[model samples]
Target: MYQADIAIVGAGMVGLALARSLKEADLSVILIDTTPIAKPLSEQPELRVSAFNAANKQVLEQLGVWQHLDQQRLSAYTQMQVWDQDSFGRIQFSSEEMGTSELGHIIENQSLVNALHHQVSQQPNVQMLPSTRIAKVLAGQSETMLMLDSDEVVSCRLLVGADGANSAIRKYANFPLTFKDYGHTAIVATIKTAAPHGKVARQVFTPTGPLALLPLSDPNLCSIVWSQNSQQADELLALSNSDFAKALQVAIEGDVGEIGVESARMHFPLTMRYARQWLSDGLVIIGDAAHTIHPLAGQGANLGLQDAFALADSLQKLAAEQAAFHQARQLRAFERARKSEAVKMIAAMESFKQLFGGSHPLKKLIRGVGMCTADAIPVIKQRFITQAMGW
Candidate 1:
């Protein structure tokens, strides 16, 4: 049987980041994932992407993984504009107004994953097993054993499931989950705009859903995330490239002048999920396994990175105390910290969705009044900036 201080299931962003953070602390870590990580240098640009909040970027920088990324391919958004279709009112937020340099950055998902994997490989205490599956997980009060598909077994003091929303590891633990299906689907892609993005991220709310244009490295390029009803999403995806672009134009109401298709569109159903328990015995769930929120705020990945940070901090504290690697107290602390943040984020997203998604006259009045109220309250604006930056 292989042995390590910790065993992580899933080598995606959250798992890799967690391994990198803990490996340098004199702890043995084994990261297992079914999909072999690909080399980022060989992939074409404008593929799957994610918005990295400021706090998450700091975490990557501290892990020394961010430095390995191609800076030229990133886009920093210094400003944002959010508006609704029912009214001609819009709210604009700028970094300058908040006394900051940037709100966040947009980067390709593969780039971030590749950089994290590269860093993990260099850590002496980290062993990465790619294209491997875990057949069984056995958790005890002080340790866990992971049975692999090949009949190989690995033992660790603690087990972490960085696996995504449909996490098998989480299921094994029987963590109760609260699930809400919005009956909406998000269509994502990249596009070329006739007008420059000007370092701004724009989100327009329509009756169907929210449409967002996030700035990319290229001035004329923008990342599109259009959330609509199931039927609307199906119709949009069924259209040809030209027709889809036309529909996108109408959705954003020509925010960036003429828009052209630059990447193939992909759609995914929307969901808001929260696991009642992130830890049981010697196992814990992080990232999407613990909580999955809507993409409206672009905080899903950022929150997952924060989970890694909190877990690493807890582990370091336990190590300093000379406690066992899988101390229940330490794991519990990690879960509490992460769950508190997740609860707040989940509530915020749900509130936003309900307030703007309704067609009632009172809701419209509240929407208009809320924008004005936000503009008038400088403190509220600053608070928003701080939250957006994950401060």
Candidate 2:
């Protein structure tokens, strides 16, 4: 039999961050995952990337993992340009306006995970069980037991489901989940543009959906996330590389000049998931396991990381006060704090989707005027910039 103070299912960035944050706390942690904990990054940039805002960077720094990340693979974007195709409304945000050197860093997801894994490995209070699957979860009044595929039983005072969107832990616990399908697909690929990205992230709202070109480490290379209706996405995916490049050029109005696809294209359906209840007795859920939002704002990973920090803080307080680890009040407190933020972000993304995806003339006029007006007002733009930075 194996045991710990807390058992976290999933060794992704959020799970690992949680473990690392509690390294100094007087609690034992066992992290279980079905896959290997770490892998070498490819020489070429990865297709799965995330925009890490200032707040997320601070969390990484606090967890002692940010310093180990490969600087060559990180791209710092100092400016953002958002515009609408149907209207003359446009807004540009710069770090200079916010008195910061850079707004955020564009990092490959795998790189961040690798860094967190390395840091967790060095922690004395954490145990990582790789290639281990939980066959069953048995929740008790004060503890939860996980039956692994190897027939080993592990028990803990608290159980956390940090797994991805399709969370087995949440399912086994019978937590209520609400899902919203956006009826769109997000196509992602890396591209080489005729003009350099100049460390700027550009996004355009088309009738179909939003297309974002985020600057990568390479000056002439950018990662594109094109979200469109299922039918349009299928058509885009069916086009030849050259044809797709041409279509992309027209989509962004050639903002980065002529473009050519430099990597394999991948697409996934867009969905938002939320758990009605995030905590039950000795159990809790975080990251995509609890909620997931659209990719339009590139805030999914950022939100997940914040969940890690919030959960860790709650757990540490419980440990410090020498309170019962599995107390429902403490767990519910964490859930309440994080769930409210998740709800706000999810709603904001939905509003943006509807505002930009609508074909109504009034919405188009409002969007155009809103963008221009927001840009004109320093206080309004500052508020937006601060919010985007995860303030």
* Candidate that scores best on TM-score: 2
lDDT of 2 by residue, 184-219 (tens): 999999999999999999999999999999999999
For residue 30, model 2's alpha carbon misses the true position, in angstroms, by 0.7
**Per-model TM against the reference:** 0.96, 0.98
For candidate 1, the TM-score is: 0.96
Give the candidate number with the greatest lDDT.
2
Worst 10 residues of 2 by lDDT: 325-334
Each candidate: RMSD: 1.6, 1.0
lDDT of the candidates, in the order given: 0.85, 0.92
Error of 2 at 149 (Å): 0.8
